[model samples]
Target: MSGAAALSRPRWSRLLLAGLLVLGLTACASTKGPGSPGQKLDPWESWNRKVFNFNESVDEAVLKPVATAYSEVVPSPVRQGVDNFFGNVGDAWSAVNLFLQGRFKIGVQQTMRFAVNSTLGFAGVLDIASEAGLERHSEDLGKTFGRWGTGTGAYVVWPFFGPSSVRDSFALPFDRLASPALVLEGGNSKAAIIALQTINARANFLRAGEMLDGIALDKYTFIRDAYLTKRRSFEDDDEEDDYEVLTPETPANPQADR
Candidate 1:
């Protein structure tokens, strides 16, 4: 097991331990940037960074190793094919969301095309992404919410999950419950399929570890910046537009009628 994987043991799941870790390591456990909890920086940004570090420590110890092991057990070609298939399905969701944002009808159509081609043309043997009129477009829930005028709120690092903004974090519950893997949850013959998919996701990301390992400075900052930038790229609207918050004082007073 890698050094990070060992430290992610869940025995440290106690709330007290988590709280103490966050408070005590606020200084050392942060990114090198100005917006960290210990730096007296931007309050929201700092809070997010602190949370990110705490979460990263957890993922490094547990998820990374498990994912690494899963990678080793699967055949490379099969893993790649399965990954592409999943991406094809995921593209459908992205397309619908992109259309909802009114930005890139071509993206929506292409994503759906990928889904169809991967399902039909490839005979499940490959993704057939290139064969169909499809292309890759990366985006996630945080960016979608940002485009809709949702504030990023505070940064939080969830154990075993890693960095998330407050707005982005709430979406996790729905995302996990609705993921394709959950399709196997209710049936009796699903155990094998679910296990296989899990392994495939892990096995396919072997290069990810090397990429992560190559980071020279604070891992927290690297992750946070990457996440934020990627999220922003998905948003099609001007996020900085002034939003009107409903206040009681601004409401039409019934007393004015009297």
Candidate 2:
């Protein structure tokens, strides 16, 4: 394959997957069973599960192995620097979203951290902001919409993008526009950078995902529940805080703690 073709394949594949899932969801909803939980909230669960399976297959075939190799071969310092660079870029956009959500104080802190890290930290290859006691913050347009009282419309499994909701899916375009990958001029370069960032992020979460294996009989439900809980908790919109995910036990705490 040509370089451009190879670079574009995964991006197009994700878009295609999303279109297929959306079409399938419409069909699946009509044939729904009677006694489902939060039917309106997750009416597309059957379709979502199929999309989730495809995403998992893609991860196993490509992303996960690449991420594993990246973690093993790349030096810790280099990986950390790459992570910091991308994180600093994200914080810049997050600051704007935070401000839009009417969080002036945290907005200022996020902006300042980005500034300090970008300049003093060698374009964010070093995290000088953290050393200076300026904490990191994460904000996205999804949270901005939530703050404005938009309900998370339906749970969606976005192919390679994994889990999201209708509200978050709507916010994705704005999020993409703010990404550092968009700053790169060359298409190939942008693709490579995005792939690198994805792998690095996945590598960081490898341990947490591995921990889920022995704890849950249904990994799909476990992941979906965990994801929803985290999303709801972010904006303090969690109507219920009692939900828990199973975790491996330590000798110090034999019983699971909720």
Candidate 3:
């Protein structure tokens, strides 16, 4: 294959994966019928279970060990700073999505939070905004779609990405585009930043994961229900109802931890 063709192949493969995800989720939603209660929301339970197992295998073989090492090697303060930096980046995108959802006041608040953190907090290495009472409003394109009345269709477990509904799966690409790391000039640099972020996030959730493993008999079902519940809370207009989950992509909410 030509050099250009080689480069384009991966891009095409990603697009194909995305296409299959959407189609599969849509089909699952359409195939719904009278059955077990779980089938109502997760019509593709069989397929989702397979993907969930794959994700767990990958996490056990790779992500978990790496995250464990990162947590042990990195000091607490430095890890917190890394979290703050990425959280600040997310705040910018949150503001945009809040505006798109016609939440002008919260959008402005999120914008201020990003501004304060970026400048006063030193490129978001410190969360001065939160200390200053500028609350973090964690909005994303998926939540925006929910706000726009898009139904959360058929829960699905994506390979590597974990739990999501049809609407969220569709919104994933757009949300990913908003990541600051992706805007960097080189693919390798972007990948490195993204990898760092993912590892940092997983490290943060190590305790929670352990707790989950102990308590949940069916880990897949437990995670799926928890994810769907959290996503539903986001769709509710009552901002006070907001909560956080231990997902790799979302920044940890300190208040929720408390």
Candidate 4:
């Protein structure tokens, strides 16, 4: 599992962009009336909110229930094994992105982790690498963009995918290639694997989603803020995965997706 893939808290990263928006909003309120709620950073706030709402609806109606059942019905060890299988698939790509971002030592370590897990770890149903001291690392293209000085662009909520900046969204297509499941020889096709990954990932965060339900006066804004906060904290993050990183394009509601 990725360091960022915790099932709780919606696991944010690369989200400092929105924290800046909060600052902007404060300044805007101090100078202008409260009616002027525009954020210079979030030029697409209106559109983003619409997509965010739609995604939430889908989650409530479909994703959340299915995930709840999966969690309830599946044994913890089995669920963990499933997650491990998927996560090892991601390490291959994360390693590549780590190298791309110029973190050669970490990249090499991750690559070795993948090799060991796929073989000795029984195709990653077990996390042998972590036991051997090679903890998982999340190095997606979004972080890659951040590393090379590409600023996180407008905050846009992808329709079914959740929060992302323009730059990160652009990398989704290329990142899809990194998923080993995409080329799996069995019955699971690329699309099916992606769907399973989404549901499993959503299940991991069920508790966090419920907690957000209790606290968010505006769910959309709350998720947006949490994600943006997580994103911004990317440079200084090193946490355990709640087992969500199914692929490189795993969308941003993110660090969770990692």
Candidate 5:
């Protein structure tokens, strides 16, 4: 085969993959079935189940073991510091999204949290902002879009990323772009940072995963319900009540339908 033809093959494959994702999203949005806690949000359950199984296999074979080893080898303080560092980075992005969502006061609070943590918390190795009564309001572009009246189209699961809605899936690229870790110079450095972040996150969830495994008859359903519930809570307008009212123009409360 010609070199150009060979190169075109990979491009075609990527296009095919993108087409499949778009098709899946369309199906998920249009298909309606009987409503259950899990089924209510997951119209694409069969595909999601297959993806979930794939994720489970990957996790059991790779992530679970690595995370287990990391948790055992690393000290709790060090792990907490790693988490805090990433969270501090996230706060900067969150503040931007909060402002975009027309939440100025909370946005300012998040900005303060990031500044305090980055400096006073020793480059975010400690969470000094929480101690100072500055709450962490984690926001992302997906949540910002939801606040702007974009609907949560459908629940879907990606290969390694796991559970996400159509809206969140679209926002994933922007989220990645917003990540401070990706700003590192070398590819190796970026990969290492991402891997550490992933491992640390998984390690933090180890106990919760074990508890879920022990109690839930259908683990997939339990996780799906829990994820949907949590995402829905983030989109809920009632959460605005938790924040102090800033201004009439920039209302603390966002719209409920997301």
Candidate 6:
């Protein structure tokens, strides 16, 4: 009976966690601002803002602290490789989009580019994109929707997930459910995957985070704006993502979206 109960326990726990993650993400999304007062908030954007804040709080309280500690313990190169591996995986999405758009040459090239480069080329150390004179682009579901002319619904801060816009907020549930991060079975397997993902995420942003440390007056605002910009850049035009509305220091007009 005890052994049976133990087996059931994990399945139950996984279900509970999955439910909680969805509920939490929904609750977070419902709380975003409408951009400002007097401007009526888009219903969707308002929700996104809430989620975005929730995500940030969770990151600060849990993930960021844990990641910082892990970084201190783990050597940087290992962490970098882990990051490269994940990035390469996400790059597959971009390659697909490019292919669907009839840019088969670019898509096929990127598939081989990210795979061979990240694996055999020492995790993108050789910078194959630069060598081949091709741009290295990021693609994800959120960005794909944006390419279809979707407006960024609202700014949302999710717990532990970081800043997200309205459109991207909607994409989170699907992404999380389909995520490789959740596939581990055994206790040790789960632990190993979590550690690797967390460390890789942190390591991937180590340089950007460090750069922000030097430039930001308010870390929260800085991260929020930077993330929003970067996410949009991934989907839409480069200019849309590059313009920063930081107070006391505004960026110059970005080139028109392509």
lDDT of 5 by residue, 1-258 (tens): 999999999898556445544543454446565565346557788999999999999999999999999999999999999999998999999999989889888888889999999999998899999999998888898777666555455678999999887767878888877655677998988889999989998999999999989999998888888776666546222254222111112233544322
**Candidate no. 1 TM-score:** 0.62
State the lDDT at 94 in candidate 1.
Answer: 67
TM-score of each: 0.62, 0.76, 0.79, 0.73, 0.80, 0.59
For model 3, how does the per-residue alpha-carbon lDDT over 137-238 read when each residue is reduced to its tens digit? Answer: 898987876665555667889998998887788789888777668679998999999999999989989999999999999998888877777786663234
Candidate 3 versus truth, CA RMSD in Å, comes to 9.6
C-alpha positional error of residue 204 in candidate 6 after TM-score superposition, expressed in Å: 4.2
Summing lDDT over every window of 10 consecutive residues in candidate 2, give the lowest-scoring window.
Answer: 243-252
Write down the TM-score for model 3: 0.79
lDDT of candidate 6 over 1-258, digit per residue (tens) = 799997998798556544544543454445544443111212344555566567667666776777877788888676655665666655666787656445566677678777776666575544555466545665565655455444454455565666665567766775554334565668787777666676667755666767876988866555555565565454232332432222112223435333
Local accuracy of candidate 2 as per-residue lDDT tens digits, 1-258: 899999898888557545544543453344445532234346678899999899989988998898899999999999999999989989999899889878788888889999999999999999999999988778798777656555455677897888877767877777877767887899999998888889999999888778876788987777776666566545322122322111111122313452
Candidate 6 TM-score to native: 0.59
Cα lDDT of all candidates, in order? 0.53, 0.73, 0.79, 0.69, 0.77, 0.57
Candidate 2 local lDDT, residue 168: 77
Candidate 3 stretches greater than 4 Å from native: 1-38, 235-258
- Model 2 regions lying over 4 Å from their true place: 1-40, 235-258
Q: Report the error of model 5 at residue 111, Å.
A: 0.2
Worst 10 residues of 1 by lDDT: 242-251
Misplaced by over 4 Å in model 5 are 1-29, 235-258
Candidate number with greatest lDDT = 3
Which residue pairs in candidate 2 have backbone atoms (N, alpha carbon, C) closer than 3 angstroms, thus clashing? none
Which segments of model 1 are wrong by more than 4 Å? Answer: 1-61, 122-125, 185-199, 235-258
Better of 2 and 6 by TM-score: 2
Model 4 Cα shift for residue 53 (angstroms): 1.0
- For model 2, what is the alpha-carbon lDDT of residue 24? 32
Residue-level lDDT of model 4, residues 21-59, one tens digit each, is 344334333332222112323566777888887988898
Q: Using lDDT as the measure, what is the rank order of every candidate, best first?
A: 3, 5, 2, 4, 6, 1
Query: Is candidate 2 or 3 superior in TM-score?
Result: 3
